[model samples]
Target: MKFILGLGKILTIAFWGVVLFNQLLPQPVPFNLLINAVGVTVLGLHILEVLFFNASLRGRSHRWFDRLQILLTGIFHVMSIPRQPQLPRNG
Candidate 1:
């Protein structure tokens, strides 16, 4: 799973790079729209992952950076941060 997430991060960065390069060309490319659409979807998923799974980091002093890392690396960053242990519930 970590490997897959790492692959996703690389793909996301490459996709955005292609999108930006397409934008700078003299003529709009036929596949640019499709690439942009996929890029947006991937970006949205990353943002949502940070919002939901990584909410605990929001209270930290370097939260902005944490959020950014979550957005870029997804669960890979989440895995690196130490999580609090869950307390037992009494009946």
Candidate 2:
């Protein structure tokens, strides 16, 4: 699972790189708007992910950097954060 998440982070970073490079190329890339739209949509969703996972992010040593990684890598980053232990309910 860790390996998968690591691979996902690498792929996501590559996608971001392509999206950025596509903007700079003088020649029109095929599916240019599609790529741009997907990039924007993913970024927006990642921002929401940051908000949704706000509680998990509060106490970490590198909170801001973690949030930035969450912004870039989305769920791939989120999955890496250690989950808080659940308390037992005494009925």
Q: Who wins the TM-score comparison?
A: 2
Q: Worst ten-residue run, lDDT, model 2?
A: 22-31
Write down the lDDT that model 1 would get.
Answer: 0.74
Candidate 1: RMSD over Cα atoms?
3.1
- Candidate 2 regions with alpha-carbon error over 4 angstroms: 26-30, 87-91
Candidate 1 lDDT tens digits, 36-82: 77667877988898879766885578988889887776766777677
lDDT of 2 by residue, 1-91 (tens): 9999999999999999998987887236557888888999999999999999988887789999999999999999999898878789999
Residue 13, model 2: lDDT of 99
Please report, in order, the local distance difference test score of every candidate based on alpha carbons. Answer: 0.74, 0.91
Clashes of each: 0, 0
Q: How many residue-pair clashes does candidate 1 contain?
A: 0
Error (Å) of candidate 2 at residue 27 is 5.1
* Per-prediction TM-score: 0.64, 0.88
lDDT at residue 58 of model 1 (Cα atoms): 52
